[model samples]
Target: MSEKSRDINFLKLFGKNLRSIRESKEMSQEEFSSFCDIDTRQLGRIERGESNSTILTVKKIADKLNLPIKELFEI
Candidate 1:
């Protein structure tokens, strides 16, 4: 795969994992975004794999979820 393709694949996987985890916590996207101190729209984009989120944003998410940063990337 091209590098861009690889990155897209990874983003999709990460987004899937993040969505699963968030749902497992029984939090709506709005609630979770508020908890993570992020914009609800941005969180939605991240969950849909449409945004290239920053590491700081990722860290904020993981922190809010009480998970390690690596957990966000788990398949």
Candidate 2:
């Protein structure tokens, strides 16, 4: 696979994992976005892997979820 394709694949997996954890916690996208101080539409894009998130944004999400940053990368 090309480097770009690999990156996209990883992003999708990460997004999927994030969504799974959020759902397990019974948090809706709107609620989670508000708690994380992120825009709801942006969060949706991130969850769909349609947008790349900065490290700080990732940290914010981890902090809001009360999870380690590494957990977001878990498949």
List candidate 1 stretches off by more than 4 Å. Answer: none
Best model number under TM-score: 2
Write candidate 1's Cα lDDT for 1-75 as tens digits: 899999998888888888899899899999988989999999888888889999999999888878899989878
TM-score of each: 0.94, 0.95
Indicate the residue-level lDDT of 32 in model 1: 86
Q: How many backbone clashes does candidate 2 have?
A: 0
Q: State residue 28's C-alpha deviation in candidate 2, in Å.
A: 1.0
Q: What's the CA error at residue 67 for candidate 2, in Å?
A: 1.1
